[model samples]
Target chain A: MIASVGNVLVWMVWVGAATACLASGIAVVTLTNPFFSALGLIGNLSSLAVLYLLASAEFVAAAQVLVYAGAVMVMFLFVIAYLGGRADAPWAGGSKLFRIAAVVTGGALLAETLVALLWKSSRLSHSAAVGPTFGSPAEIGRSFLTDHLLAFEVTSIVLLVAAIGGVVLGIQPSPEEETTA
Target chain B: MSALFLAATTEPWWISLIKAAIIINIVLVTFAYLTLAERKIMGRMQLRYGPNRAGPFGLLQPIADLVKLVRKESFFPAAAIDVLYIFSPFIAAFAALSTFSVIPWGPGWHIGGYYVTGYVANVPIALILIFAVGSIGIYGFIVGGWSSDSKYALLGSMRTCAQLVSYEVSLALSVLGVVIMSRSLSLVDIVDRQYHEWWYLPYAVPQFVGFVVFMLAGTAETARAPFDLPEAEQELVAGYHTEYGGMRFGLFTMAEYINLITLSGLAVTLFLGGWHIPGPWLQAYGPIWFLLKLGALIFVFIWMRATLPRLRYDQLMRFGWKVLLPVATLNAVITAIVVVAV
Candidate 1:
């Protein structure tokens, strides 16, 4: 069998990075200030990007960084600001409900990871049976255009409407009473 | 799956270490000089010599700046949230640094007959990860603003968050055309498809609207001019990092250049036939040729910064939602039709 050593290191880094991200993700909700929580989430995300890199997912890692780290958190920041939530934060302590939710979610994640680890080899490799390549750029592009064309069109229309809505919202002054005060 | 099954296998740690070192060095060196180049160009644009004394024609300026920043005292805002105030820059820097792992700087050429991937990450979804990192970067701006504990900083960072989130969809969707045309998420694969014919001019032509959206939003993404409302120095006295001095501030500064370089690299890879040296005559230039192409893309970024006036906050938001986003969608639709038919 034609074998190479790239596999072991990839798995090790991939698992290590995923662990770091999940650990930090837990810290996000645990952290005191919303700002710190946001920072923790960013830490969690970067680790995930690193994990993606380790998996030989070149495009996904870049997109992970660009869209999630670059764009999505921007939304979080905007939402945090528009709310004008309190900046003075006390040390964070979980409520009974959050702790329970965390435990349940944590259990689910562990179960999934266990399955993934055991079935790792089968799931890891992609076959080129469909064509000369699996997930080749050309094939993905054609599929996106042909098979998923309707969804693509719909996404565009939705974005267009959203853009118009944002403009309309921005132009309208906050209900006069708030502005006057 | 073939890529993943190899996990049971292992490579020499030294080779892996060398590759990791390469990734780190590229980001740091690129960020350092991007600042120097921006200054030199901006200086020339305004008809003045910039950093001439630093090193012959300011070649040594970025090196000097790096030393100065490292030696400078790191300070946190007194009234700020102590720990996060300190951590925001690293969060920013790390978010910025991770974007480079997937970039295909050149073809995995055989150096001494040893085939190399030429990238740190050779994954199935490289582009998605890039955008994801970009999203995380928003948290840095938000944290910096909130940690600064100042109204101006808060407002600035808040603006950044909003702008990036809104603009990113259009950016992603716009580039999806390239994804559709190229069918691969790996930037290397994208470039491979383009080597025969540049995707930008043929398939990506109609998708220029996305490019416009991407460029504008990406400009905002890095928190740079016109879209640079997050750190609107004139208004916020440096926005999110207003309270930061020394090394903390250096992180913010470095993050800006890194974002710029990363964006340009992505742009070149997706739309500009990354590392595909132009000219049938120039094919011999090889990877160095791609570096040259990257240089030109970087120059355009600095050029836009110098030429374009800063966008008003309201105008920035309005343009994104009203102008770029709609145009991007329209472009995507049109390109899909043309691409499918062809």
Candidate 2:
């Protein structure tokens, strides 16, 4: 009885979080104001993090909130605020071709999702069994260091390159200064 | 009730709920008194009585302030974004309150059939969760400022975002040494390791550099004095919440104080041996030791506010990125090497 109750609670949480994630994802694209759109994106990211938590991926869930919703979205808000009232609505003035391409891409994604859901529906019934410590920080750290060591190192190097590129771009001399030099 | 008192790990939902309710009330009451305590301490430091009229040594000042704030007119800006402007404070307060849940305040014990764990939740990633929730709390300030439609608020929010995001890196990095020594992200485990393996010595002794970096970064992360560029009232005229009035404004301040208390609690848990005294005899009085240590940290926070001046924006940025970040990284690297060797 207790196990059933726990299962029900988990199911309820998953449903609630999934609904919120979908609603917020829609709101991100549909919101007209740039700032509100950013807020919607944050909401979406946060709900996605909740979903990650529900999936028992605790470390990933925390990192999602800490990195994307916390740091990256704050930068997005900063840029939006810097633009002030002059920031354009995301979908307002795109070219007709661009809009067509967007619609086509969205349609393709929808169709692909439908195909995956219907054709692979049987696969969703059973999940792979794992240890209780799966998705924990220690477990993830161990896997990253051992099994995925090369990939992890490559990712770090890529991040380092991005940081260096950002600094270089930020420190470039103005045209007038360059001419004077 | 006896049946419900299972092991801490297997406690029923209602038990967790009860614990959460108790913890929330304790935190809220502490936050209320912390304001008065800050004022009284500041007054004494500056040689004057602070709010003596509010019922003897300003004991009732927080209640008075609450009543005044609730009764005051909540002025809404004409140009403000209504939904987000109002929602931001709740988000801020909620995030601040939730971050405390995973913080273990004492060692677990059994009384008859009742097992009580100090924290509401024993999250494996409690340390990371604190930073995560804190990041979400930043939204309250940023969104509040952005929605206010005021220049000062906008600028203040911008500084808050930049400062918080920048300092958070160093703050998280500074705790790497602790994580390395304890070999766990759980606060309970960290405290347990400190008590057992380290022979009652906290990580603060071996990881002195990390402790200093953590304290500095924590102060900056919470946007306290000497690093309070976000709400530098001398220039920004109340900063991000300039347009906020009444209970909304009160919520923002409440969130700030609660975050301060939570940070202090975290510092105690991480660097002050948590609820453990040096001897085995006083182990039963865990909560009292925890409270005393927590109070000392809070006092240090207030004392720093009274003693130090706020940093200039450039200096703040440079210090965070250049000094704190590099030092924290170096400390982490050395600690990792030492941990591996020994």
Candidate 3:
């Protein structure tokens, strides 16, 4: 009886987190004020981190909070604060063609998800059960050093390139460039 | 029935709740005295008496200050966002308290036929868990500043956002060296690894560069003096909390000290062999040793506040990104190489 109760509590918490995740995600896109939208994005990211923990991906959940919610969202909010928290123009005032394109894209996504759910998607089904080591940092470290070494190295290179690009774009003009201009 | 339920469960939930309440209350009382300690220490450093009037040797100062703050009227600027202006400081305090949950206060002990751990929760990724929660506290500064609708407050918050994000990289990298050496993400496991080592072999010895970087980055991360551009009194007039007053303002002040204590505790856990006294018999008194290391770190924090001058904003950014980050990364790489070679 106690074990069953514990299992029920887990599922309840998971459902609550999922609901919060979806609500905050909708708020992110729908909030008129950019600052509030950014806050909504943070809420969304944090709830997703909880979902990741529920899925037993503790390391990934930590990364989600550390990198995305903590760093990336702060930068986003910083930019928005400088710009002033102006509400976006109403959707009706936007270009008709742009609205149509957005609607079409959203509709397509909705249709794909519905079809997959209703038809019992084979690609989504997997027989193998996750083991004790699954999603653990040691498992990740092993894969990174062995099976996924090439991809890991490539990702680092990509990050390096991005850093360089950021520096090149953000730096002030040198004395020579200023003089020339 | 309750007995059967307790037998079936791995976690003794009631005991954990009791422990959490004990820890939280202790932290609250500590936060109160830390303010008194900071002022008294700063006063002594500058050759003057600090708050000696409130009871003998200023022992009652924190309680007196608490009462004074509670009695004062909370002034909300007309221009401020009513909701966030009030909510921000709560978030600040909440973040600090939440991070305390994962901290292992000491090894487990048996009492009344039941075993009890020192901490509330001993999660697998306790180290990163603290960082994740600590990062959310940044929102408090940002929201507090931005919601105030004052130019100085806005500028202060923006400075805080930039400064914290910059130093966070070095802070993360510095601890990466320790995590690499321990081969574990749990703080308890890290402490266990250091138990058998000699006195001279703290993780800080091998990763001295990382230690230096950690201290520098940590100063910036916590917005301590020298990196406290966010509330630079000379320039921005108390910065983010300029518009805050009464108990609301007190919360932010309390939150800073709370962060100070938590960070010092973490530094002890990561570097000073966490709660481990040398001899076998003395080992049972782990909590005392933990407090000793934690107190020493707090004293250093206060000492630095008294000794150092605030850095220029641009210079602060330069140090974090250009100096600290590269050095920390190099230290991590070297540590990794040695770990692999051995």
- What's the C-alpha lDDT at position A104 in model 1? 100
Each candidate's DockQ? 0.36, 0.52, 0.41
lDDT of 2 by residue, B89-206 (tens): 9999999999988888777778568887777877778899899999999999999998999999999889988999999999999999999999999888999999999888998999
What is the Å distance of residue B259 in model 1 from its true position? Answer: 0.8
Q: lDDT of candidate 3?
A: 0.85
The global C-alpha lDDT for each of the candidates, from Candidate 1 onward, is 0.71, 0.88, 0.85
Full ranking by DockQ = 2, 3, 1
Which regions in candidate 3 have their CA more than 4 angstroms from the true location?
A87-94, A121-128, B1-10, B197-200
> How far out, in Å, is residue B107 in model 3?
2.0
- Model 2: DockQ against the native? 0.52
Best of the candidates, lDDT? 2
Best by TM-score: 2
Question: What residue runs in model 1 are displaced by over 4 Å at the alpha carbon?
Answer: A1-77, A81-181, B1-16, B197-207, B278-284
Each candidate structure's TM-score, on Cα atoms with residue i matched to residue i, is 0.75, 0.95, 0.94
Clashing pairs in 2: none
